[model samples]
Target: MTETATAPAGGLPEAVFDPERLAAVAASGLLDTPAEGTFDDLAELALAITGAQKAFFTVADGRRSFWKAAIGLDAGAVRENDIRDSPCHILIGTGLPLIAEDAVNDPRIRDLAAVGALGIGAWAGYPVVSPEGHVLGGFCVVDQDARPFTPGQTRALQTLARSVSSEIALRQALRQARAAGDASAALARTLQDSLLPPRLAEAPGMDAAAAHLAADATGEAGSNVVGDFYDLFHTRGKNWAAVMGDVCGKGVDAAKVTALARYTVRAEAGQHTHPSVVLHRLHQALAAQRVSDRYLTAALASFRPAADGVGVVGRYASAGHPPALIRRADGSVEELDAPGTLLHPDLPPAQDALKDTTFRLFPGDALLLYTDGITEARDRERGPLFGDARLARTLAATRGWDAARTVDHLRRAVREHSGGHAVDDTALMLLRVAGGPA
Candidate 1:
């Protein structure tokens, strides 16, 4: 029989804890996990169906209710709420649907957080049951104003709660579905795309070109996202900065570090004249926040336009990252002599290794910043890498090309080198000074 109750008939469900119910909640594994679009979509659907301003898919862990999915909550809202403060405290153990026609006056829950801090005047919820008949969590609808749930509406919501339970099951299976490459790869790619900038911004007096592609193009494994990333931004003092970096590993772990490094560098961009200063800031930030051995190497360069406007001068720093190269108007290639200290909390003296190199870019000179993935791409899965010499030749041949053409040319060359499949994550950024001698 379907269980429905407006309020607890007994003292309360949590005066005592049930081990079996808590175990089912733990097995669901929905607490404190990464937010996924699948859950967001379901929450959205729930909001529309109930015509409620907010909907939350949550699991109660005895002391607090953890929201796995929520819509209409502020960005800074805490995801967990104290059980004593929430009306859902009693809902957790009962396994019965709750419909408070006037929650603000409902003696059973009027003193809860739903009515006070949250200002929620009315609410309805359905138990989320697994196939084994364990109530894993509950789906809830909330409103700031008074409202009531009809019998038909409550039944519809019950069905949706079951869907949410199934989604949790699907995601758990997907996590363990590493042997099935396609599903995990799709999820990884979704996360990777979210971390990457959709497109590079256009910097004045420069032509910018950028590209990113997955390493496992053949889909032989899940987690195809790679460690390479690039950025172009206008900094303070009428200058522009170009950044290229590679995290130490691949997939989700590397992507996490990539996101941290990119945002930290961008945060310090406008304040520094030399790239080394920014790298130092990121080094300290990561050192204080990190618990693992993860680190990334970065190449940072700041460009200030010359008064003549015919070219620009670049001040660069390298932290164990690949050295950037310049292709002059006459097609000669020179690698900038930037210091190559790797950023790590383990090395206290490496900051001095961060030397700044200054170079003049006369009109028609192109600067190329890239991650090692490009030069190290293998033609076959286990073949020789496409090393530095080949990259030099490719740059020399592209001297006759523009900024965009140079990037396109390199992409084609890499494709040829890797036989159209990348053996590692790859990224490239090309910046050409606006003019070349006619």
Candidate 2:
């Protein structure tokens, strides 16, 4: 339940509670449990310190009052009150301790037969609160005669109540952390489904397929979604464009930037003919956003259908990203060297030194582009990473397969190498030039 505190009267310190903290407190699985030895010890100590006939830990969960632990009282009998309607409700509502000298004479307690039945004429109670400032319950003491508690006794009980509050607060914090983790997982799943295309666009005289798999772990919820994206589209002139890249960082921020990069590449490819020029325009557009400490690593390739053979020409740029893999039809795999500095780096000269590389795709040749997540995945024992050499060997083994099958095999190999532990988000795109006599 949400609660707001009013300023204390007569210059006394005010008691405050936070609504969110209370929600978290309610989420803890500790409420309404049978009395245990640890709590009984606490109540016993409280009664001894306050010199009261009985002391108890009472929790009110909207419906009934439950005694989680009690001393000098029957555990079963303490469950008889509708605490929401009790005279003591005012004390809890105000988040202040209440002390009554004579319940028989005090109009507020006179009608409370439960207290008279127990032969109690005096009482004192302090509210227990979670760290986020939600009221969880109360710690209370009672006597059979009309008597005022000493200042020292009241202070001691207040201190003990604070201890109970701290316990509640700890439980609340754990619950909130778990909830946030669950929410982040759900968000990552949604982002992956919405951002990545289901299938690649078909190209004439060439075969292409792409697959993207985000790491199952590493975010606010233990799964980071990296800014990696890929796209395939056909231009007005019937030329096919395929692009793949990775953006810096991970999580929601990186995911947003990844989406922007994907669209930027597609839009520019539609407007520009040259793959190098399209990447240049994309860099300018992304740089214009003024994103702090952000940049993209990209590769753009165009394919045109030929009467005798398919022609594939591509230009790739790296902004602090790993190189791509090229697999020949003859079972040879090599890494393409595309050297460029990260965008928005601390040093302007390093950014200016960035350059692109152009390559021609021979018949039966394939190009593979991916995010660092695939290369940086750790082994089963969390030891060395699955480096580029392993990836090259895997690609070489699958060189004779179709583009779709090649991508599938590579994905399986990466998963196996990492022992199913994908610590970073990964994206992979494959383009194959069909074989025929020129």
Candidate 3:
């Protein structure tokens, strides 16, 4: 006979203090750990997108809620608090998103001492769950002024919460790999895949395609774990954003920087339309991390379908990255030049160097964003480099192809040029206006 699952006598699941749930949290390795840029970036993004006065990424057990990252709260003074006092308790109780327009007046939590002690006017949050489906804590925000949050803001907060969940899972995997002698390479591959989106988001009136070729093109697992990434996603309304970046190194450290940069751009893209502004925000995040050896080159594009429905208007920005290539409908390829320095703490201020260059993609036109791998590939070891000239010519030759075909054709060309061997990770993203080839 099957037994029916029942809630605790107190009408809750006992999830907050459940031993299995607590074990999962412990495995995350986030409890009492120092703040990290990945978590800080998420919390900061939550504040920026929601206009919240305070935000926190927390891990909670029965006894207390530990702040992994916080913004606007004095870190030294507000490291943690009793679990009963945190607004996140509501999330743990219901296993659903919680929003209280006025925590001080809400009957459910008004009596809680934290309501008066912390002076929380409003609260909004989503659960941060483990890979095993246990809710460990939450990504939450507090407002000093009691104001209702719009649906868009709440959704944005949810997106950031999911990012928190992913980061926790990555850390757990890394720890497990370290403990298991022969699993390091497998962990590296898993972490590398997590850095990229599983698939590109579809856009109206446009075709988007992307490809990634690992340094080990022979399909040797764990042999290469580099930091080349590309992303395409909707911002708000009809606007969409795309970014391609090459972080400086390999393995876990490179993966950390890659994750930081990717999410930082996503967070900034929703609030800004100018590519330079978005990238500069990412630069600030990297600088805040204060890792001298970690830096990157990136290209960003913000665009929306033109009112005529036959083309797109967009702004492009570059940070120590190669110029993006645009292929006209007439099969002519030209470099869309927008230059800047590397994204590093030692680099000059982004506002002074990074600038947006506006351009339009007419019908049948295609734009390509890529890493240096394609241009740097050589015919053989210590042989002539493929360089920009050949890349431009190859792009020009693909006049009328759709985004997918163009990406495939280019990948083939690079492979042939390098004689079937890859020296570095390669990432290519192509955006084409919906019309057929030129």
Candidate 4:
């Protein structure tokens, strides 16, 4: 392979070869990832806008040219080649578009192999620049016929190139945002996992599954997920306890509150037999800690096995949290409406120290307990909340599914309604009797 003879047109300064442009191209993280339709689509539009036969969008890093998109050429056909042998070098070296009206006659790039070997008669291309004014490559259209490009056609090509530049710039911003978000999500996930039970202990009478959603999800990847936690632990005489809650705030403070609530529940549920007593104990613990400007909202359910029967009875209670929803085997849905006070002193005292709502879960029945973040999540920024009705409808549809499937279906529904990310922390706990009616 012979490198073609080349020279810097228009007395280009040596500063143009500073190598920073190559680093900028790499920093955008757009090279060699995948051929996105975004760039290809833009090239197609450029082809139509310029009335040319073919179009290409590329990224050049001073050393070589790599095609990001190609309309008529095979994929990876122009992946790498010397800068001088390629027409794109004209744009990179001159910092201006190369509008070769007639490549066979135009001295600018006539001797280049792009014209001599490929028979490309005309080229109307502009630079695809980065946000920092680095020339990445060319968004160009080519023709097999020798023809002159009108000034209007040339201007339109420049405008389309600007649009391509804007798109490339957007990708760079998204890459940076995801990087920062990933860092935050990693730490938050570690903290969140540490605060939660490693796994929900298998109960004697039911199948259990749980999923948590943090408000930190900004892109396809998530970050800085909020403080929502749950636990299913066996406690006291052939029974199990289910705990789900949200801390008053987010990050480390909210994580601390989550840990305090879970441990307090675990410590107290063993000594006690009633739901209200456990909640009352939790309220006392939070109050005594004096976690300034912080409190927790929670729900606890204790399941008691029926003597030689096909079902279990559950006693449920909550402190300033959303009521639980249950889907019966017969496809009936009901809410365990327990009015419990938020831990703050300004709210009504925990009535009867947070009353319990006892519900029966027979074979093929499911009990779902979740934090308000699920229902309170909005369709868009400041949009209406997903609300209780939607959740009930979602549960009604997942009547006979097992715990894992039920939680998955409900999570998908919430994500669809909230445009794929919760604005607050979301925690879902689904517990179902394992088999069909015994």
Top-TM-score candidate index: 3
TM-score of each: 0.58, 0.53, 0.69, 0.55
lDDT of 3 by residue, 1-438 (tens): 111112123433467778978998888888888989988988999899989888899899888889898888776776888887776676676566777777777765666666677678988888787655568998989898788988778767866776687577567657666666535556666676766777888877788899998776334423456578898988777999999999887677777777767767765786689999888877776675553357899999999988787699999999989899999888999899797877886777787798999989988988999999899987647577778999999998888988999999999999988887777888999999888554
Local accuracy of candidate 2 as per-residue lDDT tens digits, 1-438: 112222234321222234553454456455666777766776788888878898877765554556676677764564536653343354446655667777678655566655766677787777765433346667888888889888677756765665555444334433454556746655555555445665677777678888877676644424566467787777545677777777766555655555556655654565566666666655564554333356667766665555444466655655556787889888888887666655453335433544667666778888888877887888758888778888888888886788899989988988888888776678888888887222
**Cα RMSDs, all models:** 17.0, 22.1, 9.5, 24.7
Question: What are the per-residue Cα lDDT tens digits for candidate 1 across 73-114?
Answer: 897788878766766765665656777768888877887766
Q: Which stretches of candidate 1 lie over 4 Å from their true place?
A: 1-182, 218-224, 381-383
- Backbone clash total for model 2 is 7
lDDT score, residue 286, model 2? 54
By lDDT, rank the candidates, best first: 3, 4, 1, 2
Each model's lDDT: 0.72, 0.65, 0.79, 0.72
Q: For residues 162-278, could you state the per-residue lDDT of candidate 4 as single tens digits?
A: 656655544554455455674655655656665665567889868999988767556532543546778887766687889888777655555556655665676467556677888
Model 1: clashing residue pairs?
364-435
Q: What is the lDDT of candidate 3?
A: 0.79
Better of 1 and 2 by lDDT: 1
Pairs of residues at least 3 apart in sequence or in different chains that clash in candidate 3: 400-437, 400-438
Question: Candidate 4: where is the Cα deviation over 4 Å?
Answer: 1-185, 218-224, 345-351
